[model samples]
Target: MTQRIIKLGEGYGDVFELFTLMEAMPDRVDRLLALHTIKNDEERTSLACIFKPTNQGNFHPIYICLEGIPKPNDQRNKRYEMFKALSEQFDKPIVEFTVPPSETYHEEEQYFQQIIAVLRLNHLLPPI
Candidate 1:
């Protein structure tokens, strides 16, 4: 039940990389959740998909896209719009986070570790 979060940079190529990462982790994840923030929209949208379990008893990994889309206070972007459309197809609402992007972590591993720590603190991630 361990949960981890990773953020992608606001780059055109990042979307593909993130997609590939999530697709490769289907056997290790339990759920996939994606959040997209679109411009001109007052609210955000999320899409979640549940994948079949693996023969090794591993669940599909969940993925959330928190990049490219501008914050509520910032200007809108096309990436968010794309995510919003995908979210609708998944039928999940995108949730808003009050916390801004972390500046201390320079590596994706560090970012994921921080997210895992937060999930553990909130009891959202299983203790291992």
Candidate 2:
């Protein structure tokens, strides 16, 4: 299968925007993955969420969130919690990463490259 990488930005409410987009194209999603960046290095706060395709014909939408979730040093992160809850509700694992942000790259493109790299490294994405 040919996999396409999409870059998401952090606008006023990009999370909500992403949700709305996925809701609109539920069937097109083969899997959902997310990467959330944290602020501090104490606990290592990067996270990745994955959604797998089911036999029941349900949609699998991956969400890769970066620079969104606040660090534990600050107030609790509702957005991170929400993604966690959603994963639990859908029986998916909220995978975590602890890598630094991409260097000398635009936010959106960098995010896309990161996700695609992860998928390829994990053998989740077929050679294209």
Best by lDDT: 2
lDDT of 1 by residue, 9-90 (tens): 5455666565565456534434344434443443343333333334563432334444443443356656556545544644
Q: Report the Cα lDDT for candidate 2.
A: 0.50
Global lDDT for candidate 1? 0.46
Off by over 4 Å in 1: 1-10, 16-69, 72-75, 120-128
Please write out the lDDT profile of model 2 over residues 1-128, one tens digit for every residue.
33444334443265555556545554543444544343344332333333344446443334544454454446676655765665565554644444555432576566566666777787765444
The clash count for each model shown is 8, 8
* CA-lDDT, candidates in order: 0.46, 0.50
TM-score of candidate 1 against the unseen true structure:
0.50
